[model samples]
Target: MYVMTLTKSDFEAFKELIKVTLEEQTETFLATKEDIKHLPTKDEFYSKMDEIMGELKATREEVVMFSDLNRKVNDHDERIEKIENNCVILFLFT
Candidate 1:
């Protein structure tokens, strides 16, 4: 388990960067398909396809990580709210 502390601005920046990387990878894969004839050999095309698949897997892992981080942050926020409410009630009774 990993804990990540991020401000709103930082999270937005991180999301933007991830979005751009995914878009670039998608474009590269599409462009490669169009240029496959220049690959010169069957083995070369297969190798390039393997490389693209690896990139896609990595990008997917990044997306999953981002989602997990978002969930954890939301959970933390909820816990903080509960604590704050309890504190307010305690002060009112005292």
Candidate 2:
């Protein structure tokens, strides 16, 4: 279990990085012409495609990590609320 401690500024920076990486990837893909005859061999194109796919997968995993962190934070808050409620009940009963 890894604990992530990110401030609002950290998240903003992450968001910008993801945005820039995605935009650059999109530009690279678009610059590739559809005319295979003028382009690299099928094998070379496939290799490049695989590399881009790997990058996309890594970016997706980063997003998922952020999402998981958010879920864990919510879980911690809920647990705290439950504990507070339990304390209130105990006080009333005593």
Candidate 3:
């Protein structure tokens, strides 16, 4: 173990040093009242978020509709191909 000693003056100086360092750190880390003055209100934030969610919901609906339409078109194409094949077979037989 090591031993250390501080004179009264040295202790006083150390306390002053800690006080100044704490003040500086507090200023650096803490926000002032003016810093947050321009921030939006809670209602404004919620309103904007609701708008964005609405747009996203609309986009999702459109995508679902497009997917359903594409599936129908594919089904029709498959039916057309089967009809064409049947007609070709009938012609060959005749």
The numbered model that scores best in lDDT is 3
Give the CA lDDT, 0 to 100, for residue 44 in model 3.
96
TM-score of each: 0.55, 0.41, 0.78
Query: What RMSD, rounded to one decimal, does every model reach?
Result: 30.2, 28.4, 2.4
1-94 in candidate 2: lDDT tens per residue?
A: 9999999999999999999999999877774456445878889999999999999999999999999999999999999999999999999999
Minimum summed lDDT over a 10-residue window in model 1 is located at 31-40
Prediction 3 TM-score vs. true: 0.78
Model 2 regions more than 4 Å off: 1-38, 84-94
Put down candidate 1 lDDT per residue, 31-73, tens digits, no spaces.
5555865656888779999999999999999999999999999
- In model 3, how many backbone clashes occur? 0
* Candidate 1 residue runs with Cα over 4 Å from true position: 1-39
lDDT of 3 by residue, 18-78 (tens): 9999999999999877997898889999999999999999999999999999999999999
